[model samples]
Target: MLSDVLRSVRLTGSMLFLVDATTPWRSWAPQTEAFRRVVLPGSQHMVSYHVVTRGRCWAGLRDAPPESFETGDVLVIPHGDAYFLANPPDARASYGPEEAVAFFRQMAAGELPSVVPEGGGGAQQTQFICGFLGCDRRPFNPVLASLPRMIHLRGATALDGAMRHLVDFALCELREPAPGGKDVQLRLAELMFIEVVRRCLTTMAATQAGWLAGLGEPMVARALTLLHGAPARHWTLAELATQAGASRSVLAERFVQFVGQPPMQYLIQWRMQLATRMLAEPGAKVSGVAAALGYQSESAFSRAFKKCAGAAPGGWRRQPSE
Candidate 1:
C-alpha cells in the first residue's frame, strides 16, 4: 500500500496555526517554498493544509473559485501554492508576507497555536486548524507528484470517521498543551495527512491517470509495493512480474500505461532520488550509497545520478540548496 511507501520516505509534520476567526475574515498563506529557512528548515518540499474544525469558510488558490468548506472539512495544498481562506468567499483582506514572516518568528520563539486577529477585531467565530507536512523531495515522492495542486475533502463525505476522529484529537491536543504535546501533535499531523491521502485514493476514479491511480490496479500496485519495500535489491522484470502475479509483457504494458515508465527506468529514477538524499547527509560517502542502491561501482552510480539529477552526486551534495 501507499502507506508503506510513506513510512519508507519518512514524512514529518507540525501544526502551523490553530486559527479562530469570525465573519468578514480572510487570510492568505504563501507558498511553503518561502518558509524553508524558518519552518521545517532544510525541507526540500513542504505541504500546507487546513482543517475546518468549526463553521464554514471558502478556500482556493490565487484567482480560482474558492471552494466552500464546513466543519470537519480538510483542504490540502500539496504544491505549497499561495492560497486564501475566508468567510463569505469574497473577502478582500489577506495576510501578507510580512505577517507570514512574523508568524514563523513567533513559532520559532516557542509560541505555537498563535492566535491572530482577523476582520479588524470582532468576536472569534469561525474556527480552523492550519498546519504543514514536510518530507524529502528526493527519493521519489510519488504522493506529491500524484496529488493535484489542491485537494478539497469535504467534511461530510470525503473524509471518513477515522479522519474526523484524528482531526478532533488534534484539535484537543492543540487546545490543551500537555507534556510531550508537540511530539503527539506532530505525529497526529502526519497520520492525518496519510489518512487524507488514503481517503483520496479510495475515491479516486479509475480513469484518473497518476501514481495514485496506478495503485488501484492489482499488478501495478503489487509491483510498486515490492519495489518500494526493497529498493536496494537488484530486480529484473521477470522477478518483479512473477512476484506481482503477472506475465512480464503484461506487467510492463500496464506499468508503463499507468506509471508512465518502464519498471527498470522507474527503479533507476527511484534509486537516484534515494542517492541524492543519502549524499545530502553529512559524512555520507558515494561508494556507500552506490553499493546500498545495488550499483556495482561508484562510477556507474555517478553516471546514473547525473542523468537523473542533472549533476554528479558530489556536486549535488555541494550545492547549497536542492
Candidate 2:
C-alpha cells in the first residue's frame, strides 16, 4: 500500500553532483522551485538531498543556525527550500540563485564529476553527494505534504547502512562516469528516497497528527491500506471499518481524529485525485474514467471533479498540462 502511494506520486530521482570542496568553502543551493525546469524538468515538486560522504560541514536553511553534518550523515530538504552549506557555520559567504543556476547549467553541459572549489577558496576539506528527487505534487502527495522542511538523519541506525550503501554506489558511479552511470544514480536516488521515507515513518512519534501518523495507527493504517489498495471500489464506512477490524463508530472517530476527515470524504477526494491522473492518459475517456472511479455516470463524475478540482473533467483533460 505504501509502495502504491509512492508509485502514484510518480517519483523520479536525478543526481546533482558529488561536490568536494576545500574550506573556506561556502555556497547556497537555491530552492529547487527556482530551477525546476533546468534541474528536474516537468516535476511538480523537487526534493534536494546531501549525503556527507567525507569530512564535515555546516548545513541549514539560510536564515537559521547551521547544523553540523559529519561523514555518513544525510541531509534532506523535503520542500526543496534554499539552504546554506559552509565549512564554518557562520561564514558570511555569498552564492546567489543566478550563480547557482549558471553553475548547474555548466555542469549539465558535460562537466566531469570532480572537486570544484567553491567560490570561498579555503583549505579545510569537505565532500558531499548531492542529488534531487522529483515527484508529482498535483492530485495528491501525502508523503511530501506530511514531512518537515528539513530532516537530518545521522548514520547511526540499521537504516543508515542501506542508505549509505546507496549513496556510496551512486557516488562511485558519478565519480567514474561509466556507461549507464546516469541511470544507476537515478535509480539509486529513488531507492534512497524511499528508504529515507520508510526510516522517517518508523521513527515518527505516535503523537504526530498527519497522514504519515495516521498510517502508523493499527486501525487507521488498515483503513488506509484498503483505501489505497482499492480506490476504485465503492466502499462504505461500515465496510471499511469491518475490513479494518473495528466498528463503524470507532473507525469514524479515530479516522477523523488522525486523518482530519471522515472516511467517505477522504475517499471522495482520493478518488478525484486518481481520476485526474487517469483522465490525463493519452486515450482516456470521460465515461471510462467515471465508471472506473465508481461514478455511475459522466455527468456525476463531472460534478464531483469540478467540486474537487475547480474544473470539469473535460476542461481539466483539455488543459495544456497538469
List TM-scores for all candidates, in order: 0.90, 0.91
lDDT per residue, candidate 1, 1-322, as tens digits?
A: 5765575456887554578788788878777777756777756778878888777888999868888888878888998798889886787675679778677656644685544446745554678877777777664777787788998877776456788788778778877778888778778878888888887787663767678888998889999889877888989999999999999999999999888789889888877877776776789999999999999999999999888878888888887644
TM-score of 1: 0.90
Candidate number of the best lDDT:
1
**Best candidate (score: TM-score):** 2
90-120 in candidate 2: lDDT tens per residue?
Answer: 6766666787887766664445453455646
What overall lDDT, based on C-alpha atoms, would model 2 receive against the true structure?
A: 0.78
Query: Which pairs of residues have clashing backbones in candidate 1?
Result: 139-273
Report how far off residue 302 is in candidate 2 (Å). 2.1
